[model samples]
Target: MFIYASPSVERMYGATVDEVVERPIQDSMTPESFQKALQVFAEEMALEQTGAADPMRTRTIELEEYKKDGTAFWVESTLSFVRDARGKAVGVLGVSRDISKRKAAEAEKERLARINRQLQRSDSLARMAAAIAHHFNNQLQVVVGGLELAMNQVPENAKVFATLRKIREASRKASDISRTMLTYLGQISGARCAIDLCGVCKNSLPQLLASAPKTVSFETDFPQEGPVVLADGEMVRNMLANLVINAWEASGEGAGVIRIAVDTVEPAQIDSRHRFPVDWYPDDTRYGCMIVEDHGCGVIEADIEKLFEPFYTTKLMGRGMGLPALLGILRAYGGCITVGTALNQGSVFRVYLPVFQGKPSDTMPHPVSMMQQYPKNIGVLLIDDEDMVRDIAEMMLKRLGYEVIKARGGKEGIELFERHHQSIDVVISDLTMPGMNGWETLAGLRAVDPQVVVILSSGYDEAHVMEAGGPIDPPSAFLGKPYRLQDLSRCMQDVLGRFQKPSECPGDRLQNALQEMPDGAFHKNSAEGT
Candidate 1:
């Protein structure tokens, strides 16, 4: 027997009514669809044959159907069992509507949901990283500052001094780890400025290559008129260094080439390859792109998505912060990164930064001479909640020939400053405190005297503090915690020099101060201080 076919059947299956009506239903379906239809039919027949009280009279299912041209599309079909005079199932009638658009929409929605979950996880990890970096940095400040003071007291040539130097060096390595964690958390302390991408790469190549194995070779393609980007120069340098090191390590012990290139590209060109969001591009829509390529044991497809996550690594000695920190830096600068990888072949990483409008300065600032003398008679008001930090900072300031005033907390520091603002030539306040934190203390001091010379100090990175509105008014200078004696000295001198001329101080002032101390002075002070 032949079944009737509607005119709409032609529209659905790209076949005329005559062509569809004469053929069996299975003839028009793919093998998978035909098998599925047979299974459903067999199930209904079995129920009917068993004489079930409530047999399946109608059912709905989704499946793939083919057109006359062999194109496939999804269909949701409702089938009814046609019965004979004895009420036995004989034929089938199905009404189906194309659901391909709906299915595509569902797939897109699922993809978006997955991306959202990934973003949420990244956010959670960032928050945890911030908390850890803040506390660890604070503890490091105490350790490092104390060690610096102790080292100063010991003679440079003494064996004890050598031991202390090693301890100090180890402490600094720990501080670097903290900084890496913070950077991955998008809490960088440095301010963004116009940077020549090529210049940073060229300058950092020596250091990066020094860490690479001798078997590996390096090639660079930096254009003479390289694009300048709006980003922190130090962060960029660190990012490049990490990437180059990662490439070198991945290349294994075999001979391989690592190539670095910097060029200017349009956002459209980048989007065509990477599909980044429009918001990632600046108004000009031009990007300064830096590409690092290596012939190495490349990342596998399965691990590519997890590469930017913190603490995810495959190497034996990998800390896993390198790529994640690179990601953080790009995100902080409103930039994007993409990776092209093939297992056992190689990898190419493209970093895109917003191109700055102005040309970078041609002249580099003069390096500070090591023998430059610091001014004496400068007064410093130090505010910190940590007792160890206060003591160590006080010791360092006194050694530098500066008059030091110490306060336990921000509130007390403000009170002291109000009473002795004239005597306090400069204020060095810690950003984090129990009550009246650094920002609040700065505001209070500013209210008392608009011309107050304040240097904001924080264990947190400058970017993190600034993100929390710590530098709204802009301090005279910023001092990162866990700093060395030389770093602190230079920061203070630079800040003070900007406000007033440095007075001539005796070259032997530090030695004189150390000599004046009585024997076992450190032990005596420790007993009384405790």
Candidate 2:
């Protein structure tokens, strides 16, 4: 029972002293709070009745409390048991202070800390991904290059050619996966050129549509011209593909529609629609925007901010790298992405890329054919740590009618080049090696002959290699590993043909090259002997 009340009760519980005095304390509390306070009161009464030595005289607790108006707030209450001179409890004296604001602030602080930790973990994973990609690409080069050379030797009609082609195709798929990993690691490969946004969408549509289930239909609305962006065409396609696939999967197994549209967006419009940082865009600029919308179960509001976070997914089997990689590619080119979603309604993912100012140029390289006859007397020094790769490359050079010299490693290759620098017209050097790398070998060769026509080959893309601080002096030409015979032939012709004079005999063509190869052709040859 409340025997007395102070004026503070008016502000704390919306009751004046006169109204609260002599009223049961439970009358001022909610049913839950009343029950909890009664239990504690009963426990103290029992302690007093038993005359327990050093009994609890006071207690503090935090709980939800309500005012006369029924508004609830958290309160920290300290209750002191009043006792008579004989040590028998008579009444209670309590004091409480509102701590709601402090609790709310602490909760917000904890939420921010969780987000910070997640971002830190993401950064660590990105670094690990980069290291893995570098090493994986190195080993993949050997597998791909060796398979490519073996396929070249097999006749088109041979039984083994079909099997070898399938293996090479699988290897190429593995290469694609590695490239995706690099993208997630914040490594964007390929040159940036002015590319037509509409054209990329049109080209990617067939594949994207084919991947969707039959229950879903796709609609596209692209401007005929004028929305061009300076970006890698392949990366744009990949980003579109991922967005479309995500929409397709989200559309459920029932009949649905996936809509893709492209338009030009002003900086002001972007700022109004997205919560991106103020520095994300320039004050006056236009962006080429691609929007992919789907009629499906949309993401919840709470999860929207986390959609681009690495390895965060709502799906059971998802590895969660798709959206992160897409975002990484966009950010690499000073672009951004925004999304809109509603539960059970649908979702819209908008990708914005900075608009290119000038007229778009055709940056795609013309395909080169390797079926042409080779000019004779050209020499190539093949350097590789892997014996299989070295032997296969030697066979490829021999078939192309070039005099070949093999080196097991970069150090030996440099020595071999020094001894036969004049004779070696071209050096085909592997990028990753045990002792000395391709860059070092290139540097050593350039010291001996500045005009050294060296072709740098690697499993990794040229951009990724260069970004990782590869050779300062770029090679005459670059050959991506796992290249076909035609690619090798064209590269050699392009590099060697530039130096050869009109009077020089075209390299002697090897008649019946595959059929006439001796058994010793597969044997490893030391750099000293070559």
Candidate 3:
């Protein structure tokens, strides 16, 4: 029993002094705290029974204490036994000081440390994903390129052609998976154009509904038009699918409804609730927002911070790449996501995208197209650390009617280019090589012949590679790995077309072309590397 409490107790615990005086101390403590206090008191009493307990010695304890208003706080208390005239222990004397501020500071420090650790883990996972995606995309390139070569050999009417086409499609999907892994690392490469958010969602809803279980139903609220954003349409579709699928799954095995809506939101309306890229904020005054609401098993508070982590999931057999990739996409677009949820109530995920201010071009150029024929005398220097990729690439070059010289790595490629600088009209070098990388190889080749045309190739997309600002002396062109005959041929045409003749060096011709073409017209080795 407290017997008495000072006026300070009311100030510390939000209770009046009279309300706490003469009351059982247990009433002011949590069940766990009360039990702990009882154990300590019993231990002290046992020591006192042996006459070994020092009456002047004070025992200190920190506990969570509550007051009349039910508000809890931390307090550090010191206790000593009060003695009679003959030194017999009577009552206990105790003094307590509120330590809520110190406790809160400690808690906040621990939380920041924990968040820093999570970021490090996420970074490590992202790097690992990049490495895996790099290698996987390399292999996929070979599969896709080889399949294209095989398909060309067989007539389209042949049964083998159909089989090859199916295999190629499957390989392309595999390539998408690798891209998703790269997306998680925020290294995805694709064209972005202004598109209506509501339209994209509506187009995706049919497929989403078809793929989802019958127990799940969808309710969509979309304005007829507008709320456009400058983003990759395919990636936006993938993001929508990811959110809707996650909502459906979270809705549980029983029947449930998921509501999806798109609206324009003012920047002021957005909050920082568990936003990814914690340092990011809305760059625009208005945002095109997509909200996904579900009446499923709402995310618990503990799991909210981890929802965007790659492969971290509460569900069994969850691959867990969806939300992470979505975050990556948002990060790339200078956007952010906010989450709201309560246990057993449901979750609402609001994805805010920066609104596009200008109108998109009426006609968008294709990313890849068939190449026109080039002179057979034109030569290419092909470099790669991978034997399979190099050999197949050489074959692809030859199939496009160009003389091919193969080099195992960047050093060898530079040597070959130096030896045959005049003969080699173009150099296609792999970006990730063991001894010397493509960037270093490009520099070396340019040192030998300033006009040398070098195509830097990588499993990563050209946009991602160029996003790092590229080399001081950039390559003439960028070739994404796993390219087919058409891709190789098209790149060759684009490179060679800059010059009037294949025999002459492109320096003078490039200068003339630059003079004639509009600003930003040059695609190869120019400021617009991508």
Model 1 scores a TM of: 0.77
lDDT leaderboard ranking = 3, 1, 2
lDDT of 1 at 516: 42
Against the true structure, whose TM-score is highest? 3
Candidate 2 lDDT over 394-448, as tens digits, reads 7667666677767888888887777656556788998888778888888888998
The alpha-carbon deviation from the true structure for residue 431 of candidate 1, after best TM-score superposition, in angstroms, is 1.0
Model 1 deviation from native, Cα RMSD in Å: 6.2
The count of backbone overlaps in candidate 1 is 3
Two-way TM-score contest, 2 vs 3, winner:
3
Give the poorly placed runs of model 1, Cα more than 4 Å off: 1-74, 77-95, 189-191, 198-224, 244-259, 272-284, 293-302, 341-347, 363-365, 368-377, 463-471, 501-530
How do all the candidates rank in terms of TM-score, highest first? 3, 1, 2
With candidate 1 superimposed using the best TM-score fit, by how many Å does residue 520's alpha carbon deviate from the native?
22
Model 2 misplaced regions, further than 4 Å: 1-139, 149-158, 202-211, 218-224, 265-286, 300-321, 339-345, 369-372, 434-436, 468-471, 499-530
User: On residues 1-530, what C-alpha lDDT tens digit does candidate 3 reach at each position?
Assistant: 66777888767777677778856777888888889888888989899899876767889998888867888888888988888999888889889998989999998898678768777887898888888877887777778877876776799999888889889888877887787778877787377788888888988988998999999998889998868888888888888889888888888999999999999999889986577776567764799999999988988888897888877887765588899999888877888889999988888999989998876433367564453555554667778888788767766666666655678888877776665566567888888888787788888888998877788888786767777535465677888767777777888888887643644753443344434433432222312110
